[model samples]
Target: MNHLSRRAFLQGSALAVSAGAVSRIAAASLPEAVTQTQAGTQPPLTPASGRPYQPVVTLNGWTLPWRMNKGVKEFHLVAEPVLREIAPGMKANLWGYNGQSPGPTIEVVEGDRVRIFVTNKLPEHTSVHWHGQRLPNGMDGVTGLTQPGIKPGKTFVYEFTARRAGTFMYHPHADEMVQMAMGMMGFWITHPKDPSFMRVDRDFVFLLNAYDIEPGAATPRVNEMTDFNLWTWNSRAFPGIDPLVVRQHDRVRIRIGNLTMTNHPIHLHGHEFVVTGTDGGWTPPAGRWPEVSADIAVGQMRAIEFDASEPGDWALHCHKSHHTMNAMGHEVPTMIGVDQSSELKKISQLIPDYMVMGDKGGSMGEMEMPLPDNTLPMMGGQGPYGSLEMGGMFSVVKVRAGLARNDYRDPGWYRAPAGSVAYEWQGAAAYLPSAGGSRPAAPAASPSSKETVVNVVKPAAHKH
Candidate 1:
């Protein structure tokens, strides 16, 4: 045989042997990669075959199921393209693991040995970094730094001991900007060996994520960092995100991990909480102070605990007002107290969907505006009373008096008692004394004033 033909035959045989090896490895050693397609929160996965510990509820997400193999907790994660529903009317094409973005929460004991098998089904190579973990240098999962990137159609294994008991996260260490921007992330919890330590009646977990998709597009602009249009918790927006249900007077712990570029000042109404844990570990009791709002910096995890004393639906959301709004209101011009009625008819002739924002402020939640395909309203979600005027990073903490111990279902809206709500006064309005004596009245615009006839945008036929 010729030398070139012999070389080609040897290479082909080697390729065949490698393929057989990979197939044999998958068939005999790999665990099943469990996946879920629904966006709603799944039931907490109780310890099926591992050390006993209370499982946590993942808000708008679920706990990853693992199997015991030779004394090690085995988990399989498959990375691929996924279609994530950001809200009721909007969906995004993103990359994630196990069939969802902000993939399932992984819970393990503090001292247990863990093995994670990552199968790459993406178009490009990827890697998984166990954020905030103290593992072997080679098991750190940093592409090229700790190990080579897991190429497409390849499976890699990561082994480590759960050294810390706190809130941590997992995401790609390779092509981080694009992968994270495409909605790749998940939550991880290392439970203390003593289950009684830092115990709570109910515990919740989720990740804060953001996206920069256009109003009508399905894919995000992965290069964007600051000007994100969609702010989410576990890849879900308000109204779509399930409420954090808790029993009244019960101790609750909400573990939040921020993966977005900016900080989130998470605020809760009708109650105060204290930071009890972080990525490092449990916070010392003396270092904690009560706060109505806690600021979580980028790539940080914060676990806040509080007693659910209130009985009504309380608002829990980001303090940055812009973060709560969806697309299409960031570049709007201010027209408060301006007379644009004359120009409305002229503009309406040219455009059919131009909407003038409300007079009191910008877009109103109750306003019915026309939107492009695959787009959500700037302000959305209706409450029993009226429009909620909220979109992203918003949810309710439904504290009820008679909730079952394991009940995580929505209990509907809360009803206030008689005379508890504020009513308008029918007599006279009280006036605050001016700091600089009597307030001067501004001059009214005349018929011939230039301000009375300024050129404005054409109004859309749709009402705002």
Candidate 2:
């Protein structure tokens, strides 16, 4: 191969590193999708009030005997009383991990041994189980099946080697259904030993699950899988959770785990991800493969890495359509069929802002309410009045910096960058149209014109 071709090949190989690395291609290598979009002078938005993005991290809490730190982390399971208007202002107890439902994201490195000390803060006995970790049977954290449950206030530590790198999860093993249902799950990501294999521009962790809420209430109802009411990422439903931020040309790594007793086949538009790791362990690079969607089973975790090289806002959600919305659509009927269908439609048409997000591609309705009953109030305590709303959960991953305008579009058909106001894309495409339109008109060639006569008179023959 010639020098130029050899250099090109090497560059392409670098872009394929499992870790987060931007893929830089010559303008000529630009895909047809990219060439169609035009670049604008403005940059994407940078919110002033927004919190600095924190990578989602998960830790395991289990009780075991033998090695140091036991095998678990301080996995605190608590049941707290919460007030729900639907329950007539009565307080009901909800279960959670580390005092919060949807648990926490635990991060570690591949091949590193982990020692977690778990303390049961709740009234009942519970144990932590490392979901998808292939360890000695004794250190698995199974309650009656693996070891005795840890009594309240007592701490148990479980230790084990994280053989592979991928998305893994942790939850209470005792009364698996009840405990997990009340929000006892979280996410984990294992990084590779060598930084080269782990370098990434951006990394995100998503813990997706659903909750059943009693009608017109703020609290979550317990254990109704058939009638699951709300879907959430990292415990906060859409609208309530914040957008995942990113820069254009960034490489992103996302680890998804399902603790909601259902399988979530996640889908992302624009670019595909490489399934570099699985629950069993990290697959050898030669065996690693690429895919656009993946089915992550309950109590299961999977790791995927992709290039955010494409700009614009991309939609990342569960393939199961219902999983994108609250337990159900609004109790009230649509305007077209309701008592004031005409009025509602008119108001929606005239006032853009008044119309709630009707049944669109998916329902991020629950995001308008408070965190689930099983979730801890602390993590959800950021927004005013300590409540999380849309624009808080299920965040938009900004590929590049600067204010996102309609004109600056990535090759990917990402929705327009989210506006400062909430729910601007209620009916419009995910991204806002560029200042003029999707494709900017090439600058009209300067009109042809005759040259002007020389106006500059020689400086009086220069009096020297």
Steric collisions counted per model: 2, 59
Model 2, 234-307: lDDT tens digits are 55554344345566666667766677767888877778888766667666788877788888887666778887
Clashing pairs in 1: 347-458, 354-460
Reference-based lDDT, each prediction: 0.81, 0.49
What lDDT does candidate 2 reach at residue 227?
66
Q: Give the per-residue lDDT digits (tens) of candidate 1, residues 115-175.
A: 8889999999999999999999998888999999999999988888998788899999999
In candidate 1, position 293 carries an lDDT of: 98
lDDT over C-alpha atoms for residue 198 of model 2: 59
Off by over 4 Å in 1: 1-27, 358-360, 428-464
